[model samples]
Target chain A: MSQKPEKLIDKKGLRLDGRKPEELRSIKIEVGILPNADGSAYIQQGKNKILAGVYGPREMHPKHLARPDRTVLRCRYHMAPFSVQERKSPAPSRRDIELSKVIRESLQPAIFLEYYPRTGIDIFVEILQADGGTRCASITAASLALADAGIPMRDLVVACAAGKVDDTIVLDLMDTEDKKGGADVPVALMPNLNAITLLQMDGILTFEEFEKAVNLALKGCRKIYTMQKEALKAKYESVKEVEE
Target chain B: MPTFFERRQLVTPGDLLAEGTYVTGENTYKENNKIYASRLGLVEYEDKKINVVALRAFYIPKLGDTVIGTIVEVGFSGWTLDISSPYLAILRASEVLSRPFRPQENDLAKVLDVGDLVIAKIMAYDRAHDPRLTVGEPGLGKITRGQVVKMTPTKIPRVIGRKGSMVSMIKQETGCHIILGQNGVILITGKSLKDEQLAMTALRKIECESHTSGLTDRISQMLKKEKAKQKEEIKNESKT
Candidate 1:
């Protein structure tokens, strides 16, 4: 690994990745990638690679846990052994468990679980690679997967991260900036509803800086929301092409 | 009042369809006097109402619709059927047995055992209970032998086409009996295995490319081509 740069923001007022303060990383998202799962999606943002799959609104196993009023939403966030510089254990670690819960909560707001009572919908997210903001990306992909599964949702959820570096706020913090920067904030949003479903902060920032980071992150989220819709439409457009 | 998208336009969840007095129909929600799509589908305008035709969805059993399912459990009073839905369907012994059912004297599994496929009609369905199915109706009973093809339930209407034109064309071309189930289960049966295989292929094609135009013509051509290929194979075998 290269030595940490002394300044995350260079003299040109750009991030280490040569992006402007409010610029997001390159992101590519594909929906319904896994045919076996009811719905699935893959997302790549910068160096991060994540796959999310959704199953059900089907009958719940251990029927006692099934809710009478609405479908139960479950999620699992796992990291691959080769996803990082150090091999991560395949077992669910404390961070993975916590992230799974956060991701599920972040996604729950979008899905209309009441449509299917006495049922459960399961979302599994596998982090093939991790840079930073895996939780945000996972939330983005999981909601898209839920939509692809034909699950009713009030809105699609998208996420992005911003952080403070050298007294300057920047959008879409990468792994190095997150580890070395002053503060990191990840945010997930339902763009149309103007609702923030997930918000997390690490390190420290002043009140004004924090506010600026959140606003920047939200702007990044809104940008990604458009791509999320396009990915869903592209899935069917490709199928239409296959017909011709 | 400006509608964001045209009728039949593809839309994703949270897209504003219209911002006016348009009535919100199925798969849509009204908020702040705006109707937004709640699912990824094609927008539709039905008189004063706006609805979305979902491209893919699970089978939610509706009353009087025919469905095919596999028996998963044989209870004392009823049989549990897996109809590829969030809820399992229930078939009472009274619905199947012509005579009065006596639990001790009669065996339920003997009639419709687990894993047995059956074509039935949805007798009753509500949010409170599992769908109740009855199999005593004419042409609805145990599926003895045939090929089964599964598809997205939302695409079933496409498989049927406009007023049953596509299905009837398939039946005529492949010369097979096709039973279209609302639960996305299809049963194909014919005199020969080749004929059944041809019908299954045609149905699968229809399900995959259901959104495209000229689908009926495509399915007709597909079935006819397969039929011609099967005839040629049979002729070559006789010569050999």
Candidate 2:
């Protein structure tokens, strides 16, 4: 909102990643990447690489933690010790736990819990690189992993972040923009019906500005949803062709 | 302009949605929706409420999953195997029914040495704790002097085929007792090293080309050709 930072040199209000205020980063996704996981995916959006592995919908839920009506969604979001610029601590710190909780809540709505009553679905999302918007990346990767697992889902959950930088709202904030941006708003959307499933914003923004940011983020989410659909369709089609 | 929820939704990496759309109450929301730019994705409106679907896969270890494992540590009760899953597997002492008459010091490593390649079954997986495994049964144990090949655990079911037809075909052709680990570690051993090498090559082909149909027939023809070649070489040697 004030003077632009040196890194955010805005000739026509575009970020260093060559994206406009409402443009998102390029995303590449591959499903069933992890052999051990029931469903898994590797996703790369710009420099952010994330691997999500899904396990369960299994019977046991730990007697004390069992739910009566639907299945439980347990998620763990972790960064590999070598994922960051510098090596992170080996053990999960408090920050990781909190992030995991948020991710779990975001993914729970997409899962069909009633289908597998009294069981639990465990999703482990690992950040292989931390450029920016790790949470959004994790959500996208987790959704693809779920689809690969053949679990019944209404639609895919696509996530992306939008923030204000240099007096303009930019979609898909890169690492530098995230740190220096005025306000950061990350969103996960069910792109098909145009619904909000997960939303988090930090820093300062007026109500109008916040709504605009959400709108821009949604636009980015739609772009990502197309890519997700294409990737899954391509994978299955390729296999099916081979079978034929 | 179309509203956010009305647009043909597209999902991008790292998009977040509103609070109530995906979760319930103050902080929770639904998972997957059909709505564009909505955090929960698209939705099919019914009965004034939306139904959300999961967009990720779920890992479930079944009764006879063939897994690739490494002997991480040896314990008095059993040997620990790191199968790259949430839970590690234990090959218990009792499961190893054929123990030496008088167990000498360091006998565990002798039979199943540290860092030995093993293809075992998921005898039982306890959600409360680690999974219990058994390599002592026929066709399961510490795999020494055999080549190990890796594949996706999901593809194991396809590779084995219906009612073990695929595996049986491979075995009859190669004359090897192949142990399929639920975790995708395949162990194949033949009477001689040459036979073992041939089997390993064939199995690797299967792993890579599993998506293709009629694999059984293709592999059967390949093996028959190999067998005839071997017979011709043997005949030439006898004439010499």
Candidate 3:
């Protein structure tokens, strides 16, 4: 693949973010962070701030399209007006709707929806700040929100993006790398089972390079899973002490 | 079993798990083979799944929650209230259980005009539909005088505490009759504006610092200090 000029200054093979090609960004996750929703979470990966709120498993589905066997996962991904350099419209545009659909699909396999047959789980993800890898961050945030809402899940979905930049594969691409680099690939993985729940790629890269990028993203997912586990544990411990 | 915090535990973002073994309908769960509990509430649990709910110290209105709102807008058959929710609540003409008084065409606003806050309850919710509200009680009309402050709805439960403990403490200290709106709006009617402002300030401080340990004791001490300071100022003024 023909790569763009290098934006990351590699010192001893380490990128500008002080991370090696195989290292992921620093991630933070919290569960039950929102007041109004059944479950909610806030996640921050470097400069990214994503808040995901989960409502439902409620019986109030659309009257016309009610299903009896499975719960519908309605996902909405929206960027706050102040999330990016340019202000986005408050209303969900076509791009937002498409992104929502993709996210909903990606999460469907992880949730045990049949447990709440005839109900629906609505996951709303709002990006307070967007640096890069928003889609993957949303996936991770939504999973936590769902779990916070106490929805059953086969496994937590961990997501992170990787790409080829400056003729080298990088894990967990930063905002600058995503814009100026080549062959960006975002992947969501069931880290416990090592299964890919979602995958997307843009830009140009050969099959061999793509495989390397995928491997890097999967490794990032595992790292993220550990962070997610710690967040939930801390929240619980704090509350338990209060009760005791 | 999760390890106990021998000292104060400072919780950060990356400390909790996204999913774990939760006993359904319980507010606590097990993550990494360790059991964890919720600080605020157990919202719901079902089938080995549990959800922890957070309590807000300030009041914010939710659909169908009963709240004391103020009539800020008077329309044809209803009045608009300044509930702390995102949407303003409306008390319809029919929902007003008053004596047989036919409201005149132009008298709608006259009966309940702007600048008047009321105490009404949210009767119905139209998530995509309009909110239907009601003021069917004696004290549900326009609020003539009071000061208002906003806080998160989730925080209201904490501020109220278990069976109104926190609110009663504030009321006894300030000698102010406080009306808490479900939508994070608080109305404080004191002997004067200064007193009202002081009460409001105290409430806001409490909301912001609710999660801190020894909150109730701290607030009580703060209130006592403020009272003593005010008493000293009055004494000095009298001597002068």
Fnat scores for every prediction: 0.85, 0.09, 0.00
* Candidate 3 lDDT for residue B23: 48
Candidate 1 or 2, higher DockQ?
1
Rank list by lDDT: 1, 3, 2
Worst 10 residues of 1 chain A by lDDT: A1-10
C-alpha local distance difference test of each model = 0.91, 0.70, 0.71
lDDT of 2 by residue, A1-244 (tens): 2344686846866677677677777888887778887788999999989999987665445746757666778889999998887799968899899889878777777666665555667899988888989999899889888767655555578888898887788889887888887999999987644668899998899898899999989888888888887776565456446656
Mind giving the per-residue lDDT tens digits that candidate 3 earns over B1-240? 223322234322122323444342323334456444333332433344444444322232345566766666777667777664434567877676365546663467666677666767777864443356777765565577888777756567667877998889988898898987776677899997767877887898776655556667778788889988988999999999
Q: Alpha-carbon error at A64 in model 3, in Å?
A: 16
Model 2 B-chain TM: 0.61
Who wins the lDDT comparison?
A: 1
User: Where does candidate 2 stray beyond 4 Å?
Assistant: A1-20, A29-135, A138-157, A164-170, A174-182, A190-197, A232-244, B1-72, B81-86, B91-126, B129-145, B181-185, B221-240
TM-score of 1: 0.95
- Between candidates 1 and 2, the one scoring higher on lDDT is 1
Candidate 2: tens digits of C-alpha lDDT, residues B186-208: 77778877677777777766765
Rate residue B16 of model 3 by lDDT: 35
Off by over 4 Å in 3: A1-19, A25-159, A165-168, A174-182, A188-198, A203-212, A221-244, B1-51, B55-65, B70-73, B80-82, B86-88, B101-106, B124-131
DockQ, per model, reads: 0.79, 0.09, 0.04
Worst 10 residues of 2 chain A by lDDT: A1-10
Positional deviation of B127 in candidate 2, in angstroms? Answer: 3.8
